[model samples]
Target chain A: MSEFVEQLALCVERGKVNRESLYPPDLHGQDGTDELAKQALEQGLKPDTILEGCILGMDRIGAKFSENKAFVPELLMAAKAMTAAMTHLKPFFQSGAVKRKGTFVIGTVAGDLHDIGKNLVAMVVEGGGFEVIDLGTNVTTAKFLASIEEHPGCSVGMSALLTTTMVNMEGTIKAIKEKYPETLVLVGGAPVTKQYADKIGADGYSPDPQGAVAILNKKVA
Target chain B: MTSFERLQNRMVGNPVDRPPNFDIMMQFATRHIDKPLRDYYLDHRVLVQANMAMLNDFQLDIVQAISDPYREAFDLGLEVSFPEQSLPISTSPLLREPSDLARLTTVDPVNGRRMHDRLEAIRLFREKVGGCTPIMGWVEGALAEAADLRGVSTLMLDLFERPDWVIELLEFCCEQAILFARAQMAAGADIIGLGDAVASQVSPAWYRLYALPYERRIFQAVKNSGGIARLHICGDTTLILHEMATSGADIVDIDWMVDYQKAAEISDNDGPAICGNFDPVKIMLQGSPEQVREAVINCLSIGGDKNLSAAGCEIPINTPYSNLHAQTAALSEYYSMA
Candidate 1:
């Protein structure tokens, strides 16, 4: 509702990080998410309100990406802009002034060293307002289970770019559901599909980062 | 008909005994010979041995030197590590900063360790089955090599942030690919497979500006060397299929997500041969032999005579032997009846 919050949302949606950053040429030399979020907070706006604006921006870019109106560059820039704004809100989050929706544990399954897809999903999910525990690439079943144990009730997401590593998703998902039956497990990658996801007994599968956010949000809701 | 004759006839739209199978097998071939993936990627003898086994066992028409994307990057001085039975990893990117492009230098394919290994694979294939089957040698497309050196996420941002620097890097990568392709051709490769997998992640406009020109250059070099050029970009490439058709390649691999009918319709009537549309995981690794046969027939029907029977990408290492057999078997059965 506030002008500063709205401006911050535009900066994130358009990927304008700061006045010094020259991307999105249309927003050149203007105050970006870094300044606008600071301004929004200084003016007494709630951290939650600012976070809502950030998530709104991410949602817009994600929608555009899914429709082919945007691509990885646009999404990465938006995530970067969101990250810039989130820095000012970190203190609030630390002091119990801001609360996250939930935790999402994600990784590229074992035997798959590719992390681009896994990283993108982590960024988008974090931008969608969740505490993301990124386990990095080549994450084995034990690491995933340990993370789940540490972050109880956290939704699990696995990615594998190679078809060879995709089979690892099955073993990891089976191990997780057997131990944490109620925890939602999602899988995705270049080779992963809804059919493969279902065959592996995964709770959900997404083809894009934005879709991954939507799935996590729906389950959390 | 000889495998080479079958492929040549299919390329010219001539009737063949059956569609020539062009399945990309990397890890699958490695597992076939009971060799570690590390050996398959590093040793030409191991790669050639595995491929020869594929030719003998599956009646594969093409023997390929595609092990991983890191071959050129590793030779380019990137610190790439090879696991015993896993894909290579490059944790520390060579170009951590845009200015780091200055430090990058081109390596001669003959002298470069990994690139030379691929050429050796082609030479061995020529020695073993020179006149019988086609031998495909691979090089990373300019954009893909750039991503390998600069990291995918960082290079993606560089496309927007440092356009000039990205162009410089692309030009350097393109030159290396052209030289590598020409060297492979001279080493006895019948076809050169250029993989620009990163192009699928960018917008069509960026692809045209940053990736397409370089791909055209590399493919043109392959053609100049009397080698058939094949373009393979992984993922849903429907958005850029029209542009890809004009990239000077003889064959353009269509990933499973792109509709076979749509890809066929987009290419020029005299365009590159279209090869694939089957899901490697669903139809080959997970599906029964019956499903594999059905998918092969369906793709052939949609892709018409210009189609090559193959999976969308590499055959998964664990795909059931029966399902792998079903693809070529389907073609033989259907075409025999026809």
Candidate 2:
């Protein structure tokens, strides 16, 4: 059972989607997350155990990505493999056999339509076993407020790629904080920094999606 | 010395009156001067005035005519969303399938709305400056233009799922970029700036296989058309700096995450001037004038004496005017002593 969990975790880390998937060159034709995860489940592994394995794999990949040992392409592949395995476990989650730690609300701020950064964060956060509420790009402060209201205790993350729309982050941050002071808000993007995050009263800032997951994990923990 | 001479000297690896302080000006800044975004990007006069404001107000060395990445993508018939006071975005990607390439038409730079607008901006700048300051004409790099045509997510998938299709699309983008480069050169642009912000997202292997060839083609196109090429790939490009330098561009614009010294060592030459490596938000938007100056000094030291210019990525529109002033002041102070 422990060996199956370890293999599932390694599959997620290396991004092996299925037995036939040829990605990661070295892992070509090997049993992927799909087979390993199903085996784990058929062997009576709990849903929580499967989720814990995923979290462990994603945490490792995210940290490696943040430190520059891994790039976006690698992370995307890992996320894809993780998603394939998670699909099998979805039934368990839907039946209330397993519960996600918390919800995360995220979007690129208004006037900024870029979504790659936001999407990456959403994917990594979701792989970390959190319920992600993606608002898409060009999201206004009102939209974010509504999302926060819907999720209640959920944390929010705002992204901006353009220099112009980064200013709008400040307004969105202010509105969310004013309406829900207890709700945590994280900020990031190409033009964002820790200083700007602090200046705008955002609770956290991460340079990459892995950092964002780390911050979210810490907040939830 | 005149700004033109100062820029020329800096570009050629010589000491100048000061380091060249430049920014890839955005249409969002036009709101500060009360011009609508669409009108500013369309009208050469409005674009020039906005860029002039950036130079005059901030002492920028080169006044750029970069409005957004949509111009080339738009000409290729990609659906785009235009918003007020923000860059226009590609709404629907142009390429839906690999076979769709046969139906796509190449846009002549002189005939298209956005490309023509950019060309006119360069022409007007040449007429206005005429050796007073260097004017930069803009083009989208192949991968970035391809992403605009195929949607970023789809393109990333295409790299692995359909490598041949990615190559075909990139070829089209490169051919169009060469044509665009020629038109800007004809319009008297001293330097052609290629914006490929999306290239940073790919792995170095994919970059070497897909992006590098097209970059080399575009760089050669600019040089053959009698203009210098300045390649700007926004984001963390540290992994591919060695591959990037071999593309033969005259200048490379480093984003905030790449270290200047590393880029210099990888380029293995002094004349391929590097423009940036500062965090636009931390040092330009949020930092004090003193901090901005310190950042500039750090960039200069890391870049060494070989014709290094100063800028973070694109300067933030809301960056304090004093922060910019301090940047230029530091350049002048450093150069004067050198």
Candidate 3:
């Protein structure tokens, strides 16, 4: 762990996006994840190593979130910081010089407009090394099926905050299974239960984002 | 004793004849009226009809002026869309820019469309149920109102990126809550409910710092206005139980994720009298009548024999009439033994 990588990890964990982005006042005016990642690449640190830093940062925060030691704001900030760092690695990923884990396509089910949970899961999954195609909130079943068709091997995820909208997960899962039975579908939200997942025929359910990451890894692995 | 007398007695930790039942129901009421659920929000007449019908049918306590959370945002002059079959959506968030906060004006609840609709509901509830039943007026707390006005994501980031602006926004919304509570209380609301569901999203530290003080202020203001305050935060609020207890509310509605018995223990029966903590969806909606009765009994023992019986939150409308009736059986059966 060199200075820059350590600094980058620290930045991601504390949610410092750039030198001027003053979130964690302790590191105010310090080079954040964005600057540190760029400097690391310039200093000949491999893109994979920098990405490992991002993953490490996310894992630390994600684990804390699982333990209830961190809440949505902290996890969200870390994700924002991770995104800042990932911007530097995007070109390498595009050029095939960097690789990613499997894709995870996620959304809030139709008639449910909440994206906070879906966004949190997407960020954590992306940090876990998956290429996340976030379909955003109020996503219809047709949109989900079309996304799965476009990304044949992608694992599907859906979220719903409202109890009224949670039932839609059942229909969406059934529709997906009808078209692509082999595709894995995951469901979660405040209202969703493992029992409900079992009832709905969803392949998996995770209460927290890191748990979602672990489930995605199991499927991909 | 009537249900209102039991609730009034229980508010101060007095021994009631039996525990009183108090849960919010929109779905069950919607089914009773045979109208679109959307009508409940759009028409105060329909809202009152549904509420009165549920209370009359189930013999439940609390004639409430509660509806969706966005009514305050709508009253604040943000354009809100009511989808025919879906929840209301605020088309434009009020806090697009920090400057937008300054441009905002206070909402006169009597004059604002949705606020007046709720005021009308409160007046109607009072006229219908009056002194016989406890009537509750609802208001969204700072976090919920802030999220409504300032998009939730933006509000989340603002906590870190724009702390000063977040406070200002919250303070603005706090005043909004105070205004809403004041108006509702003056309009014959016996118990004013402050629903800050998003308070659970922040850490206990953040909640204590940013959210709790404002909540205390709102509750205090409600008290000054001669109104009882009810605090309801809609998630697992285990970590902040002690702080919630200190907010000067007459009752705090616990969610299903938390153990009501545990909450009463943690607060030493000194916290606002605990209401709720039952799984509305599971017990009231999905459970058989026997299960609902057993649940109420379980709550009585766990919450130390003196608390209001409320669902973990709101009961879904589709819950069977038998299960809803079973909610009342808990109280009657307990009294029968006494």
Of the candidates shown, which would achieve the greatest TM-score relative to the real structure? 1
Chain B global fold similarity (TM-score) for predicted model 1 against the true chain B:
0.99
- What value does the lDDT take at residue B183 in candidate 1? 95
How much lDDT does candidate 2 score? 0.82
User: How does candidate 2 fare on TM-score?
Assistant: 0.92
Q: Tell me model 1's lDDT, rounded to 2 decimals.
A: 0.90
TM-score of chain A of 3: 0.95
lDDT by residue (tens digit), candidate 1, B98-142: 888898889999999999989989999999999799999999999
In candidate 1, position A105 carries an lDDT of 96
Clashing pairs in 2: none
Worst 10 residues of 3 chain A by lDDT: A1-10
lDDT of 2 by residue, A111-214 (tens): 88889889889989988889899999989999999999898899999999877788889988888888899999999987877877888899999988878777
Q: How would you encode candidate 2's per-residue C-alpha lDDT over B131-233 as one tens digit per residue? A: 7888888889999998888888778866765778788889999999999989998998988988888788877888888889999999898898878888889
Fnat for each model = 0.79, 0.53, 0.68
Task: Provide the TM-score for each candidate, comma-separated.
Answer: 0.97, 0.92, 0.97
Residues A1-221, candidate 3, lDDT per residue (tens digit)?
Answer: 76666767778888989999877998899888988888888989899888888888998999999998999999999999999999999999999888888889999999998788999999999999989999988999999999999998889999998778989999999999999999989999988889889999999999999999998888768
* Candidate 3 deviant stretches above 4 angstroms: A1-4, B266-269
- How far residue A193's Cα lies from its native spot in candidate 2, in Å, is 1.6
lDDT of 1 by residue, A1-221 (tens): 76665777788989999988989898889988888888777988888887988888888888899899999989999999999999999998889888888999999999888888898899889889998899998899999999999999899999999887888899999999899999999999988889889989999999998988888889879
CA deviation > 4 Å runs, candidate 2: A25-31, A35-45, B28-32, B266-271
Question: Could you say which candidate leads in DockQ?
Answer: 1
